[model samples]
Target chain A: MSSKSTTKRADALRSIEAIVQAAAECLGRNPDASLSEIARAAGVGRVTLYAHFASRAEVVDAAMSRALDRGNEVLNAVDLTGDPLLALERYIDAGWHLVDQAQALLAAAQRELPAGRIRELHAGPAARVEALVARGRAEGAFRTDLPIAWLINVLQAVMHSATEEIRAGRLNPERAASHITATVLAAFTPPGIPVPEPRGGA
Target chain B: MSSKSTTKRADALRSIEAIVQAAAECLGRNPDASLSEIARAAGVGRVTLYAHFASRAEVVDAAMSRALDRGNEVLNAVDLTGDPLLALERYIDAGWHLVDQAQALLAAAQRELPAGRIRELHAGPAARVEALVARGRAEGAFRTDLPIAWLINVLQAVMHSATEEIRAGRLNPERAASHITATVLAAFTPPGIPVPEPRGGA
Candidate 1:
């Protein structure tokens, strides 16, 4: 209605955006970051932050949702059809950014959110992996000897392990995708079959 | 020393052992188990428990040390010589019990112990895996394409993932060793080589 009221509304929305963005960056850097630290990063007063989020958990919840939303955009664009192995590589490459962000935010989320809630947020990404693995197994591209769930767990574990390797400075970030692709492909290849070569050149 | 004093010291030592053992079981069952609950489980009064452990962290640290000590006993007995693949299978089968125990205690350890301390406690087990992988690579039984650290991380991650799978009721514990061996052997095998068959019937 009134121009003055509209201006106030815009200002409030702008402040919320800034807080969430800064929260993502801050929590990504340090899971133990305090609300005061987040407020400082957002260039807002404690009062302003409190006006929006009721607690640190609320802030973390918002930050996690925002990060996942951004991640879904990247993941949704990857074509998961066609050759199972190739699709898997594309998924890993595209999903790397999300994995990086999620790994960073995971500590904070664990501290602030319920385990079930965190699992709920991850269900979509996980379902995608499960479906792809099932398809690969049916096509004989993946090992059928291990339970499908075990195979899926191994795939996720390898990716997470790669993230950790990068974090520990033992592996180059630039080379992570290729390394992950190589390791996972070999692991998933059916027994009695020669492991596949690394797909993309490191 | 007086005979009375010697008897008192022995009783105190036994009480301490009881407390630590009970703590391991309680924390294993629920990482968030309270000090009072631990005391109850130990069949000791609150006063007696606090007399020995000043705080929850102290109790957790003790429990972790005891668990690791017990785990080392089992892990130490596994002969790590001979065929790397076969050695690995033996290592997995023997280490499964330790993995089950350690996984249960990990949550409590993470909550009470410093990250560095936790890593330090794990360094022994981890180094064993690293050394084995290095040897495997040198012997051409494992791939040299990935970093030694990445390979070690994957092996550990897969084992932990298997533990999670069993916890989720998706995998039978009886089959975990076989599944872990199969997944890991395939992952580590040099590219262009056929993945190894599952060692030991599931």
Candidate 2:
């Protein structure tokens, strides 16, 4: 609790933050990036990295966890009480931001981690979306016959696909996010219902 | 030609077909499968494989070409003369067969093949899908607000994702093809239009 001890604590925290950020960036650029490369990018020594994380897997797990934490915050912030359709769109719009922020980590996580673990990371957001879909169905905003789980999966797939399109330069990033929101909303609209014009017209 | 010469040519053709099929199977199982392993799977010697394919790249390319040929055959068989919506469903339903048959090779192809080469391979099918989407739009069966190109991309993405879900055991293969067809049809239906229930409910 002394001033010198507090300073040391602050310095340690800063170094850890820098290392984690650099690891995410390095892995984003090259999923197979090495520890030394990450260390160099963080402007830290190997000793420092090893002191905080023991192995490459640990580093990857930490980076993914950090990314998921950021995503969860965005998912948490979407106002669930509003129009269920708008809430779904808001969640998806915010979801894309999280995707952009964790672009590199998301790809790396899929490649490097087990599916079960990846599912665990996504469970929270998936549940939130599931709730939104349930609400949409209740409000007659979404189809009632399709399984709720399938609808949620479609939303996730469309978002992931949009990310791929943007990365592949097939979709412009400016319109990609809004396009995903519109496509998803359209997909969920019930068979008997009329959908509003898709947002962000092509 | 002499009978002996004719027989020899037939045998050579059989060997090439066997080798290509084996290469695809092996690459599907292991993207970095050894040439010797592929030859063994084909019941041929390494020398024979090398004689037919100078390198692994040649083998991979040949396998991909073989898969694409099979896919083109399926695409060709879809009766484009029917109702545009039914034609689209038929194309999607049949497309799943190609996707299943080439699943392993497709994944390996993406990882090992150049993007330009992959794009070239997809060019034919993409054109077919784009034409179908345009037809659907013209028929007033699909939304006109979105670009035909984007709609085609969505169709491709949804199919690819459904394939992944099946691979991951999240979706039953029995229902996956139909589910995909339904999801795609629903996604394409224009605003103010009511699509019949999505094909496979669950």
What DockQ do you compute for every candidate structure? Answer: 0.74, 0.49
**Can you write out model 1's per-residue Cα lDDT over B1-202, one digit (the tens) per residue?**
9999999999888889989999999999999999989989888888999999999999999999888888777787888888999988888888776887677787899899986687678787777867877898899999998878777777788888787777777888888888888888888899889998775743
TM-score of each: 0.87, 0.87
Best by DockQ: 1
* Model 2 regions more than 4 Å off: A1-17, A29-32, A47-55, A200-202, B1-17, B29-32, B47-57, B199-202
Q: Write the per-residue lDDT of candidate 1 for residues A1-202, one digit (tens) a residue.
A: 9999999999889889999999999999999988899999999999999999999999999999888888877788889998999999999888875786677787799889986677678777878878888999999999888777777777777887777777767788889888878888888899899998886663
Give me the TM-scores for chain A across all models, comma-separated: 0.85, 0.84
Provide the global lDDT of candidate 2 against the true structure. 0.80
Kindly give the stretch of ten consecutive residues in candidate 1 chain B with the minimal lDDT sum: B193-202
What is candidate 2's lDDT per residue for A30-101, written digit by digit as tens?
Answer: 778899999999999999999888888778887888778877887787787778877887887788878766
Worst 10 residues of 2 chain B by lDDT: B193-202
Find the number of clashing residue pairs for candidate 1.
0
Q: Candidate 1: where are CA atoms >4 Å away?
A: A1-15, A43-52, A200-202, B1-12, B43-54, B200-202
